[model samples]
Target: MTNDHDVVISGASLAGCTAAILLARRGVRVALLERRSDPDAYKVLCTHSITANAHPVLDELGLIPALEKAGALHNDARWYTRWGWIEPRSAPEGPELPYGYNVRRSTLDPLIRARAAETPGVDLLLGHRVTGLVREAGRAVGVHASTPQGDREIRARLVVGADGKDSAVAKFAEVPTTLHENTRFGYLAHFRNLPLQGGIGQTWFLEPDMAYAFPNDDGVTVLAVLPDKKRLPAFKEDLEGSFLEFVRALPEAPPIDSAERISKIIGTVDYPLVTREPTAPGLALIGDAALTGDPLWGVGCGWALQSAHWLAEAAATAAAGRGDLDRSLAVYARTHRRRLRGHQSVAVDFAKARPFNPGERLVFSAAARDESMARHMYMFAARLIGPLRFLNPAALAKAAAVNIRHRSAGVSPAR
Candidate 1:
């Protein structure tokens, strides 16, 4: 059937913008709908750290230098545990893994939105919110959107929900959802002159708790601390003070505590990390809307861009007139699940308890003590190494050996 556009993407967030840009680049007509009137608007609650895995897509869209010029920071990582610090190591060429850039959502999000608008065949409708999906015979065909002008219909060949964790389009598409008890709250802020030690992004895997501070461009930094639900009462009482105090409580938090505040401490309590089947007839979900995950791994932004690319590729194939759209959606769904499910599954599972695992503790501890081990741990943390690689028998055996050697050397084991 003839439609106003090839795709109507809800939510002008990173995923939506990326999807729109990708599709438009491929010659598909795209309509991007945003609920906010301000084109510069962004989700302040997010860390806004984009990883190395997302670089290729950004490069393809010609956004890498743009983002870097937008005050994004290029920083390596270091992990902190009760035992010690694990620093990042250099990699030999070959599209170095775990490479990443960090930019504030305020800057990054708007830049992407603008790029999407610039792409040929892409029309951005700001201040318009999609209330529901339009379906015919149980297949999504378009979206019902409400603009300042009032409610109206926008027809499209496919509808994409990039609306995030509480996605209205996903709900309208009638996709089944599963929610888990995520009792953890995230508190964060932007800071200036944070006394960063060793020039590496750091995360303190505190015993039964965790706190992180990432260095960014423009002399700014992002600090976040995640405490169990039961321990949130204090933070909720005084968001800034508790957040700062949590960071200071870490074994190596003096540097962060010394930093000057560049923004107010923002807090999100019991933010539900959810997952659902991301696709169905004529519709697909991207980013948090498709698979809400724990922010602890800092995988959200990367996954969002990556998933958008996946959908764009699959959609191009499905729209070829030779393949069934259903089959295309299924393929996209399977690929997403296979690529991310294993990793996110482990992340969600680990959220249930403190960081432990004889092998893990051993390797992480060794990383803190040895530079080589630190690189391996950093590679894993940065998502350079796949989950299966870490689970390999050889890797496990190596971890065990490292653990024994460290113990014999009188180094405190990471737990």
Candidate 2:
């Protein structure tokens, strides 16, 4: 069947733009639709922390240079636990993990959108809001959208929902999602002249709360707090006040209040943990449209770009070749599940606001004392490696030994 395009992607966010560029470069005709017409508008309810795992994707898209030039920070990380600080070490070659971007969505959205629109086989449909799915014989085949011009219908070989958490395509297609409760809502703001040391970010796994201090580009720091839901009364009473006080309460707290506030304090409450099967018939989901896990770890941006790459590779020739598109979608779905399910499972547990289990105690404790264990933990957190590899037999043994040594020395193990 001849269609107007090979793929009609809804939502011009990160995933939509990435997929359009990739598929168009693969010689597939793409129609990229965006609900917003403003080129400068961006997502504000995000931490803007792109994990190191996304470096390869950015490099492939030729965006790394521009991102770094835009003031992205290549900062090292230091995790503070009750036992002490767990500073990961690198080899003589330098930092083992590649640097991730802290670029604001304002800067990145335009870059990604412009790149997608400039591609040869892509048609950018701005001001087009998708209202429903077009299905044939129970298979999603296209999208029905309302544009600034008027209502429109576009048929395609595949429909990609790169929309945000409340995806219209997923809703119209009746895709099932398992919503996990997120007890710790996040509040953050960008600050200027935060006086970071050696450009290292901080993660405090405090007893009942957690905090992050990331040095972004342009000499600005993105500081944030993830407080339990029960603290809503205090937080709601004063967003900025509660936010500042919480940071000051951390051990060896920085002079955050002294820094110039570059942006208003932004927050999100009871953000739902959304998980769904990424493929359904001729429809596929990417970014938050696929799986919205805990935001505390800040993995959403990286996963969005990575999922787009996965789908591009899997379905590059499905529409043109005489291959089964469903089979190609299956490959993408299976790979996505295998690569991310373990991480998501663990994240769901943390999202529940429960304290760490014994295994977590041993791992974090060992990571604090041993360089090898710290490297493993760092790599896992950076998402360069999967959860299984991070908890390999040798690593677990090292963690156990580290805790044993701490006990022998009369030092408290990390809880």
Q: Where in model 2 is the C-alpha error above 4 Å?
A: 93-95, 410-415
Candidate that scores best on lDDT = 2
Per-residue lDDT over 61-151 for candidate 1, one digit per residue giving the tens place of the 0 to 100 score: 8888887787787757777776666766664553444577888888888899889888888899999998877889989999888899999
**lDDT (Cα) of model 2:** 0.86
| Tens-digit lDDT string for candidate 2 (193-244) | 8875546888889745788888876777888899888888998998878998
How many angstroms is residue 100 displaced in model 1 relative to the true structure, after the best TM-score fit? 1.1
lDDT of each: 0.80, 0.86
Clash pairs (backbone) in predicted model 2: 71-217
